[model samples]
Target: MTQIPDVAVHHETVVPQAQQDITDGGPDMVQFVDGEGTRLERTPANTPYADIVEALTPEDGRSMYRDLVLVRRLDAEGHALQRQGELGLWPSLLGQEAAQVGAGRAMRSQDFAFPGYREHGVAWCRGIEPEQLLALFRGVDNGGWSPSELNYHLYTIVIGNQMLHATGYAMGMQRDGVVGTGDEERDAAVMAFTGDGGTAQGDFNESLVFAGVANAPLVIFVQNNQWAISEPNYKQFRVPPYQRAQGFGFPGIRVDGNDVLAVYAVTKAALDNARSGQGPTLIEAFTYRLGAHTTSDDPTKYRSAAEVDIWREKDPIKRMRGFLSQKGYADDAFYASVDREADELAVRVRTACQNMPEPSQERMFDEIYVDPHPVVEREKAQFLEYQAGFETEGAR
Candidate 1:
């Protein structure tokens, strides 16, 4: 055996850039709409995406708004179920509705998506039932829906791991000659979703390196919702995720996560570029997590109330509703109908969550492997024997 050399490690204090403030995306951030619902005047930065936004019809606007509302409702219901002790835990997508909805709407059916656990809104866009998601939280199933059926992968709980999975899948698509085929129906791209914290993971960095080298048709969507649980963006890195993408040899864009139009246009453009053999793109969705990281967390402990208040002003649902009203794309009745639908969805979600059947204790051993192993069989027997001891004790 060869002797391993011992290397001393040095630690340095992280000094984030003062100029590159994570709080605001600044002028470079692509936004088509303002917080007040006004369509912004086209600037040079937004010029490329202007046509994409302009081509949207009133019906499309209504449909996007509908998705935003319904997804929000689904999220609200999930949060409530957790509060009511119906779920093991719930990750709320309270404020990032537009970021997810916009990206979800931008994808072609052939395109595949790998999402972080919090992407309930994206699941909505992918035709995943709210009950299916609830099943995961309620611990009824490993994954309630089929990834192949929806072209959406199962929710990846391990931080940043999905980036590798998505990159490998994109490279596979490249090998299969499904990318840059000139056929709209044939060309497909893979999208990997993660939070700002994910950028710090080695898997994310490795995936970017591989994607850049292979020119994989991949889009790494970083929903920079300000905080990585307790740690803020300032603690994550000196350069933001988009700017960091340049080091990996791909173009990256930061978009207003609250602006549905901007997110849709940017994501559509990025996906198009990937499909056309332009390689990977990193999208930093500048948004905020208006709620706790998960049901088990308390945002009030680590975050300030004032910060939450400020983000509430940039609420994606409110912003979209404002734009729809301003464009005359939806009447009051239409808004009311959407609200009714959301309420009905909430009821359905609540009912489904409550009705989910609890799995038998033996169910845990059923799918540990494709083929049964002696060790697993022994463990199952031990577990059953241990469980029977309680019954024997009760009889005594």
Candidate 2:
């Protein structure tokens, strides 16, 4: 018999276990920095993952913090732009900055990255222009960056599809003899970004199966932000989500997704392991989504304002900033400069988005094939003639 809980009990049941990490900050989580921005002791007695951050120079620390601030400011500004009607819709990456940044920074130039739609931070780490990140939402057909040139593929709006693409790419890398080479610069790896929601799709499961069977040099980076929109992880999986990776013949590690330092260390190690011919690994970044599911969602309908308040204390940007300040790695001047630069970036993005030219109507037919296609050309001509009959340019 099923014992159904009342509404109050049901809400408590689904709430995530974020607070449990408060006592010994890194237990059950791989963290270099705690929620209060204090750097925990790096010893085997504490977090075994401490070796990754142990050698980071002060300069490296400062740059990581700077990037965190810039990404957060960009995300906030994008949300405001959406509310002001500058974009069609936005899938906010509000609380997942650390997860994306750490994974992206770990990649070498020779490696390839496949991104989900909400990977603005990853795109930034890959040197993608801020305006390019907005184009897809700004009614522009293209995001203005070449995938092959940047080694960062186009964002996949279709959930879990990029993982499949990444698995195939990793297989190709293996066939090309790019993995397990002693030469560091010549070896290759593939990184795929997906969300907790994306893991449920069959494409993701299939990708893991292919990766495991082939022993491909791939890292499956899953940002498990606790909720797939309003449906929490409890509703989606019966056990811890990261554990599923072991079932597919790979090692899965859970990390403190809000801790940028931890994420960088873990991702880099995983990528190196893959390049060394180790099988695929799944990194489940344990984090939360602080904003609505999207511009179209109203989280208030299903979530408590209190839950959001708790996650705010663990904001990635704030945690990294505090750590840098305490260590004297960054001062007020450095922070002020970052703020000014972020403002300049926001202005540039807004201006570019406003000025993006509408794509030509014939562009739809232009990329169908390298060679001419008679059927498409005929249809295109007929469509243009029909448009000419309508007197307005907007109709065309």
Candidate 3:
């Protein structure tokens, strides 16, 4: 069960006919249903909010359920591996699968993705190999994939660093004339994902400034999971996170992060707008972090069991399951099949982790310089000689 929030609906009329233009119309901030699973069916005028039940197709509903289940299982298995000392640390995406998968699915194959460290679900959605991600946690590699290979940049561990990278890439795309002109394949966009805590960093804000001024085809998808290592959402913003984007002169939307339909719809619209030369959009996926910040942090120390219990009711997986079951798109057998697939994936991840080999010392110095550098050459020679001195002492 997942808890729903109590939101009030206010209606207003736009008297000016000119202002009612739908082309440049604003988003509908929708809040229906309470945290307790009670439903509300009213839509305020001029607001873009839609009911979750009405927004999804049967297939889409089933897909969301499967996405949540598979991602959560992967996260859980990764955490278990960390505890077993197979991984140095793992960031659990236990509660945020809907936000990642929904937004990720909105991207085109040519569009690029910039992810923070915890966006394993986004990587998964982008067809990144699970072993490639595990290699990072296992300390066998910094990042194993090339950005051009998958249209996804390497995961940024430093808080808020990837925002600048995304903004810069979007600017390059704009300069290369890779955006607009109605060619969806050539007209591409970039998505930068960060968290609630990252919003406080200067890099995040600077990226927005750059993207807005350049009219870069980029979407800043902020996953507001309500905690930045024990700091609650209220401590960071008086209003919603999306409201901050208005200062940058672009449309900003706050959607139900747990509602996969809402995330997909909102992100798809945002990316389409960007690709069409409409500039940037900021989307705040309002969700919760149902697990520890990482394997090392204990939520029990800072958050109450009551709080956890409340969020548990609003589990994204459960909501999608409910929708799928109600729509007759999925049955017990379907869920069982998904579970079996996830189990197989877990075994694959484990096997991959066990087989990862240590990088050679010579390879580290090889890629450090493209052209010949005398200083680096001297250092490499000295390093090898120093190691050679200890060869008999079991140093390699």
Candidate 4:
């Protein structure tokens, strides 16, 4: 059997020169960790984010670290499954894990989440097991789990449908008389996840209109991973997505999406405000997608290798672990233990994926007028008869 290499060696822990003090993305972006693995001494003004990060008990910090590590492993395993033909397709959520987990963990249990197709990380945070995410791509079922059970709707394939679903849900939550209830436990908000490309969809704009008019308690979390499936963000929108919220009469904020700490802080605050009866907030998580749009995509066609390398140095898991190690929040032993857990997770996911039941040919003709269909029964019988007639596997 081939041996799996050490996770640490496989992942280069080097912090590049350009990444040092890397607020170079912009001074305006909210960031708690500078690229050099050092937590910034000061927090961004007007944001009580630092206090939140500071208040995290050591357990809270470690739990977030575990969330990032596990989800990244889940994503990597999905990509491998697709490449090996175990799955038909996969949308790699490599770099966006932090953005998803940070935002996901910040939500209250009562809050609802409407996620795009690529929200594996969010699904993890919402209490869905990692292996369940593969059922769709494995072709066993077009639709996987029941959304209502998890309060997380189905993975939406249509670009901007999630936004509309989220907005409509938020309005329903209001009509249900749950919003602004003095009891924090009863009051809840809706979180909608979308990509930069989805923002240009007509449904997205329409949803915004409805949300603005209804004053829905919704937080539109946009993970601006910089690529709308080979098309860069600049090609899709002229202005930063968050900035465009002003025209719709809602507040918008951009955060260092790659920095999980910033993402958690911003998302928590946004949800709190929304649940408090403040209108929707559009948060543009300025992050990058480290992998291709899907297993089949070749990002090299449009994006440059140098750009990928640059983002590599700012990897969400690496930086979070780096800062944690530097600040003594977690020791090397804890990180190693997490690495072992990640390796085990990857193996378990592979086994589960390999064992996923494939749909039978008969399943296609399954629901022909549920009451009863003589014609459907006749057709099924004919097909089976024809198959049984052939002795050779090729003929069958």
Question: Best candidate, lDDT-wise?
Answer: 1
TM-score of each: 0.93, 0.90, 0.86, 0.87
lDDT of each: 0.89, 0.82, 0.79, 0.82
What is the descending TM-score order?
1, 2, 4, 3
lDDT for model 4, please.
0.82
State the lDDT of candidate 4 residue by residue for 247-366, as single tens digits: 787877778888888888878887887787877888889889988998889998987778888888888888888888887889989998999999999999999999877787776567
Which residue pairs collide in model 1, if any? none
Candidate 1 has its poorest 10 consecutive residues by lDDT at 1-10
lDDT score of residue 143 within candidate 1: 81
Off by over 4 Å in 4: 1-25, 43-46, 364-396
TM-score, candidate number 3: 0.86
Task: Output the number of the TM-score-best candidate.
Answer: 1
For candidate 3, lDDT tens digit of each residue in 152-190? Answer: 998898999999999999999898888887887789999
Off by over 4 Å in 2: 1-26, 43-48, 392-396
What's the true lDDT of residue 63 in model 3? 72
Ranking by lDDT: 1, 2, 4, 3
